[model samples]
Target: MSHVSSICLRNSAFSLLVSVFILMLTACGDLRESKVDGYGLPVVQIEMNSETLGLLLGQVTSKRPVAAEVKMQGDVKMKCEVSFAGQSSLNDYRKSLNLRACKNHPSEQTRFRLAAQNRDKTTNRAILAYEMFARTGMTVPTTELVSAYVNHDFLGVYLLTEPISSEYFHRRGIRVADIYQSKFGNAGFRKEFSSNLSEAFDYEGDGKDNYAALQGVYKTLWDNLSDEEFERRIEMQIDVDNFMSYMATAVYTAHWDGFDNNYFMALDKTKRKLIVAPWDLDRVWEKAFEFNPADFLSRNQLLFRMMTISSFRKVFASKLDLLLENFPVEVQLSNLEMKKAHSQSALAMDKVNGPDLEASFDGFEEQIKVWNEKIRTFRNTIAE
Candidate 1:
C-alpha cells in the first residue's frame, strides 16, 4: 500500500509541472500578439461612421450617405466629420453613380495636422476664407479639429464640418433661368453677353437682386478706364476680369502647397441650381509666394490648369464689376484682423510636436512672393 501511494504522488507532481509549462508559453504568445516593436504597447484601431458624419454636417449638405476613416501613426488619432454636396458628372465617380445634389454628394475628409504642418500664415488664409464665405452668407461648413484616444494611444485631431451649400441654398433660393442668363448668357442665342441682374434681386429693390452689383461695378469699371468708350470697355473687361482673380489664386495655390485635390461644385437646395464649394484649400497664395519665380509663374501647368484659371476669372469678373458698383460704401471697408489671425496660428503650431515645427513652412517665402505679384495684378485691374 505504501509503495502504490508513493508512485501516485510522483505522477501528480509531473502533471502539475507540465501544466505550469503550458501556461507560461500561452502567456508569452499573448504578450507577443499585443506587443508592437516589443514596447508592449497594444495597437488600437479607430473609425468614423458615415452616418454620424452625415448628421453633424447635415446643416450644410442634404441627407445623403457620406463617410470617412480615421487612423493613427504615433500616439495621436483624429476623426473628421465632413459635409458633402454634389454636381452632375464632375468625374468618373459621378458618372458611375449618376450623382446629384439630393442623392450622394461628393465631398472630402480633412486633417488638422495639415494646418499644423504648414506655415501658420498660409494656414490662417484658409481659415479666413472659410470664415468670410460664412460671413458673406453664401454657404460654408464648420471647420474644427476633434480629439480622441484609446488606452495609451493618443488620437490627436480631426475636423467637424458641414456643407457650404446649406447656407448657400437657404439664402439664394432657387436657380432662375434669368440668373443663369445674366451670369453665363444664353447658350442658345450666344448673340452677346447679357446679364439679368435685376431678376436676381428683389424686383422692387427689397435688396436681393439677381443683377445686384451691376450699376455700382459698371461705374467703377468706367471710372478706371480712359473713358475711351467707357461702356464698351467696361463691358468687355467685366466679362473676363472676375475669372482672372480665380486664376491668380489657383496659380498661387499650385506654387505654394504640395497637395491632392481642388475645388468642388454643389447643388443649391433652395434654388435647385449648381454652385461652387470651397475645397482642397490647403494650397493657397501665401504659400505660393515662397516658390521660385520660374516655377512659380507657370505653376499648376497641367492639362486642366488653364481651364481652372480661365473659368474662375470669367465667371467672377462680371460679378465683381457689378458688386463694386452696387455694394454699399460702408461695407467696402477693410480690416487688419488677418494679422492677428496669422499670429495666433503661429503660436498654435509652435505647440505642435513631430519633425522640426518651425521648418514646417520651409518654402513659404517663395510662395508668398508669387502670390503677392498676382494680388498686385488683381488690385491694378480693379475698376477705379
Candidate 2:
C-alpha cells in the first residue's frame, strides 16, 4: 500500500499497453505491404532458378513444365510447377504461363492460368466477357486481372483464370462422367468435316473408349430422323437450356472463335445430358457491329441443325433477349470505365506489350456501342 508500490504498478500497466500498441502497428504494416493492387487484385510473384528459367524459355515449342516457387499476396511460399501456356502465344515476347501447386501445397485448387493478353490491346476483353457470361447464369470460370512477375522481372498485367478440369467441376459441386475440349480445325458436329471424333474433340477422360456409346449417339443423331424425332433424341444428349444459354452468350459477346472452337462439353451425370461451357474468350468483342448470328451459326452444322427446330430457335431468342435486358449497354459501359480506372497503373507499366491503354479503351467503347446496336436489331426482327 505504499506510494512507491502504487507507482510501480501504474508503470507496469503502461508498459504492457505500449507493447500491445507496437504489436498492432507491426500487424498493420504487414497487411499494408501485402501483394494487392489498388483495385484489390492479387499480385502473383513467381520465382525460378536461372537454370530452370532458361529451360522454360529455350523450349518454347515444348509443353513440359519446370519446378518453381510461387508467392501470392504475402502468403507463405508454395512449391509449384510452371510451364509456358498457349500455342501461338509462345511466339510473343510476353508469354502466358500455367501454374500448378505441388501436392504438398495448402491450396485447394492446384492449377491456374495466367494469360499474357498479348493480342488484346485493352487487356480486359476476357475478364469482361467472363463477367458478362456469369451475369447471364452461364457456367464460366472465375477470371481477374492480375499483375504478374517472374524472378523479379515484371510481366505486366495478366488475366488470372481458372483452367477447366475435374477440380473446377468439383469446386462447383458438379459431377461429370466425361469432359471434352474442342481444338482448332474441324471442331463442329459435321461427320464429314472431321475424319474421326478425336480429330474435332479431345476426350479428357482416362479412356476414350469408355464413352463409345455416347460418342456414337452424338455422331449419328443427324442421320435417318424426322425433325420431331431429332429433337427428342438430341434433348437426351445435351441440356437444351444450357446449350441455348451458351450460344446466346457467344452471339452476344461476338465470341467469333467460340462457335466451333474454344469451347468445352462435359457429360453431366446428374442431368444425364451433356452441358456446354465457353473457354478462351480473348477474341470476343472484335467482330464488326453488323455481325450476323445466322452467318456464325451456318459454320457449325450442329447449331445450324438446331436452328431448324422451331422450339430451339424460340428458346435461343428468349435467352438472347434476357441477356440484353439484364445487362444493358449503360451497365456494360460503366463496367468498362471502372475496369480501365482500376487497371490503368498496371497497363501503363506493361513494357513488353506496351498497349495504348487509352486508345484501346476508346476503341472498345465504340465497338461495344456498335455490337449492342447490331444485336438489338436482330432482337427486333425476332419480335416481328
Candidate 3:
C-alpha cells in the first residue's frame, strides 16, 4: 500500500518460452494487423470494458507479432477465431470473419456465453481501472473497450488488446549471472537488485540462474545424470530459478495467469542484443483487494506464504523496485483493481462461482473506474 519507490527498478525482466503461443503458431497465419502507425505491429482486438482497461493492458511485448488495441461498448462487440490461420491468434478471426466475440459472439469465440447471456461484457469499472494504470507510465500495451451484442442483443462492454510476448528476457540473449556480475558481482540476487537499481535502470534476470532447475543443478552438482540429460536438466533448472524470480515479482504486482505469461524471445534492436523481454504478468493483485474489503478473504496457502516470506522477499527484493517502475501504470493499477474485484468475486463465488457470472463482472466495472481515477488524482497531486 505504501508507494514502494525503491522497488521502481526491481530488475526482474527475462525470457520465458510459451507453450500456448507455440502450439497455436505451429500451424501459422492468424496475425491481426493494427491501425497504429508508429509501430507496424499486429494487434489482437477483444471486447474490453473501459473500466478494466488497465487490467487488459498488462504488459505489451516487442514480439515478432506487434500489438494494437480497441475497446468497445454500446452495441459493438468482439469476435474470436475458432480455427487457426497461418499463425493467427483468436482475434484474427474477429477481423477477418467480422464476428463479435464479447457477448452473443458465436460459441467458437466464447464457450461460456449463453443465448440471452452476455458473458463477455467489459464492465465500465474495469475500463477505468485499466485507463488509470496506463496513465501511470508502466509498460502496458495499448487498450480499448468494445461493445457486445449477441444475435442483435445488447451486451455492455468488452476490451481490445495487444498481447505481449511472454518471454522477454531470454530473447535478449543475456545470462542472469552475467547480468548479476555486471551489476553486483559478489552480491546475491536481492542485494544486487537494490544496488543496481539505486545506480541506474536494470531489469534483466541472469540466464545462468535457474531455480526450477535446482533439481537439475543438484543432479549435476552430485554427478547423478547422463550428459545430455544433465545439460537439459540444467537448462530447465535455470528457468525454474527465473520463473520463481518472475513469480516473486508477481506477488508484488499481484498478477495472475502470469504462469501463462511465460514466454521469451530475443531481438536485435541495434547491433547489441537485449535481455529477454515482454514478460506476461500474472496475479496482478489479490493483496490490495483483500486489504480493501471487509467481507473478503482467502485461505492462507503455504506455498503463497513461502512466496511472500522474508526469504522469498529477500530473493525478490532487488528486482522489486525496478520491476514496479518498469511496469506500466495500467499494468500495476489493473492488478490492484483486479485484486479487489477478485476478492469481491470470491465473496460472490462463495455464493456461486459459475452461472450468471455476467452480473458479477458488471457489478465490478464501476469499481475499476473509480480506482483508476483515484490513482490519477493521487499521481497528479504528487510533486513529480
Pick by TM-score: which candidate is best? 2
Best model per lDDT: 2
Q: What is the Cα-based TM-score of model 3?
A: 0.29
Q: Whose TM-score is higher: candidate 1's or candidate 2's?
A: 2
Q: Which parts of model 1 have CA positions greater than 4 angstroms off?
A: 1-125, 132-137, 148-152, 163-261, 269-272, 286-353, 361-366, 381-384
State every prediction's TM-score relative to the real structure. 0.36, 0.85, 0.29
How do the residues 174-284 of candidate 2 rate in per-residue lDDT, one tens digit apiece? Answer: 898788888764666766643367777777765543555346555645576899988988888888888888888888888877888888888887998888888888878
What C-alpha lDDT, on a 0 to 100 scale, does residue 336 get in candidate 2? Answer: 89
Better of 1 and 3 by lDDT: 1
lDDT of 1 at 231: 36
The clash numbers for all candidates, in the given order, read 46, 0, 111
Cα RMSD to the true fold for all candidates: 18.4, 14.6, 18.8
Which digits, one per residue and each the tens of the lDDT, describe model 3 over residues 1-384?
212222222422211111112222332224433331111111223322222222212221222221122223323334432211111222221211122222343222232111111222222232333333333322333444333222122222223333333222223333333231111121112222332332322223345332222222333434545545544543433442343344334333333323223323222233222222223221233234343211111111212323333443344344444444554456644654564343343223221223455564544444334433433343332221
Model 1, CA-based lDDT? 0.32
- Candidate 1 versus truth, CA RMSD in Å, comes to 18.4
